[model samples]
Target: MKKIALCAAALIAAIPAASFAQEADSTEATAPDGTRAFGIEPYIGIMGGYDSYDKRSEFGSPRGGKMNGALIQGVAGVNVPIGPAFVGVEGNVAKGFGDIDWEYGVKGRVGARAGESGMIYASGGYEWVNGKRAYSDQKDWIYGVGVEVGPKDIGLGGVTGNSGVRLRFEVDTYDFDSIRPMAGAVVHF
Candidate 1:
């Protein structure tokens, strides 16, 4: 009887070890080569924070105010793999409101993914806004770096599909002294 009990314990331990090995094998099999063959991911997000405006002698005095607002964006782009690197572009539209004022703009970003699920990346592009129009212009450049966390098959072809949340921190120099942090989610199809 004692021998049988010992055998049962040994079997249970072996079962867990086998299961772990299977999981590791599957992860390696599905490992992304940093490329997305084809996919359509549309995301909508909101950003809120503060903006510090450098006093332009020609414009007036230095003014800093609370910057909090919402943005609705649609992204249409492709994920490509260059060796172990992942590159992609996204077209976006943003509408914002805050103490500084209200404005909207269209922008695009080009970035690479490193570490599983692009745990980190740097993206930069241009933005055109129409509203109170700070700096006596209609638009400007928007660029920043951010970190993302998700699954390795996020944009890869798979049966389970890609669905996860993303958070980004960005600083735009278009307005002389405007820094913003944005957080949002993405649904890949």
Candidate 2:
């Protein structure tokens, strides 16, 4: 939707001004070697996965009244590290195959650092989904938990150290209406 895109753009544009207004402090994110992490890290990635709906009737069945399909998505977000923990906001737009048409959402994440550049976090947000014209569109609240392991933690530190790339895995519920699982890679800057 135009509104969603505009809102996400506004949020991303405001990050720098907001972050710079804050004074540097000891609470800032730090690496294992005691160096400060990027004050505000912005990232983007592409993910692919599946979405299974709980109510087949609402989504219209392409296969024996069963509503489910594969999805590919684009993701973007920013993280602010605070000591060993971090907080961030992310936005995603997805295209679906089979019974689904499209999906989009925005979420907020909060969690602690895991092994060098890795992170362990939980997220919640609002999502809008569109299915085959067999039914009306739907929107709901979504919640999930995920992890991101940097190349260094995965044993690529020697080659990709500070490259800002990480592997991400996540699972979320569409307001208890559906189960969604996704995985991808993200690069921060």
Candidate 3:
């Protein structure tokens, strides 16, 4: 409960900062093609990260430790572009390391885009943690912030031949205690 409260507080505190970012990017919030980002972006990608577990009150058994590995997850979401701001809801499923065999969640995100090249956003969601231990599966909330930068945004336009392709990096906390950091490639179209 403490972790959830902290995450909620942090997200609430970030609202003003997100507003400032949107205001700054309002003058130029288009993609490279001079159009706002839109549509249902369904993407499949692989994510590798370190998963840390809570030491205290993490269940009565202290057998399973932290896991460091990768998980392949599929994400599908729709983005509503409102001038320089964007809002979206996404759902994902992943299989990974440690006592965590698999997990799934749905998240909502809001952010500001700097042209079509990149975006910075904050997200929170409800997740089900599928642990390897019997009776270890649990439900909880997760929150995090992330940034996406595309090839077009970084002066790699002609070479990458990529539209809506972006690099994703984020650090998310689950069960209000476990932290998982992930990075992957995705396309918005």
The TM-score leader among the candidates is 2
Q: Which portions of model 2 miss their true places by more than 4 Å? A: 1-29, 33-38, 56-64
lDDT of 3 by residue, 1-189 (tens): 757666775675466456546656455554444565444445555556666666553533555544334566767777666545567788888886655788789988877676557778878888886777543777788887888888877888887765678888988887557777888887766
lDDT of 1 by residue, 43-156 (tens): 444444444433442223246322333444444444443333334565655554533343444444334345555535444456554334343334555555566545553544
Please list the C-alpha lDDT of all candidates, in the order they appear.
0.45, 0.78, 0.69
Worst 10 residues of 3 by lDDT: 59-68
Q: Name the top lDDT candidate.
A: 2
User: In candidate 1, what residue range of length 10 has the lowest lDDT sum?
Assistant: 29-38
Order the numbered candidates by TM-score, best leading: 2, 3, 1
Candidates ranked, most accurate by lDDT first: 2, 3, 1
User: Which portions of model 1 show Cα errors greater than 4 Å?
Assistant: 1-52, 57-77, 99-110, 133-137, 151-165
Question: Once superposed on the true structure, which residue ranges of model 3 sit more than 4 Å away at CA?
Answer: 1-33, 37-44, 57-60, 63-69
Q: Would you give me the overall lDDT of model 3? A: 0.69
Per-residue CA lDDT of candidate 2, range 1-189, in tens?
Answer: 445644654564456346534635555645453546557878999999999987554565555565678999999999887655667999999999987899999998877678878888877789998887564588877877899988878789899867788999999888766788999999988
The predicted structure with the larger lDDT, 2 or 3, is 2
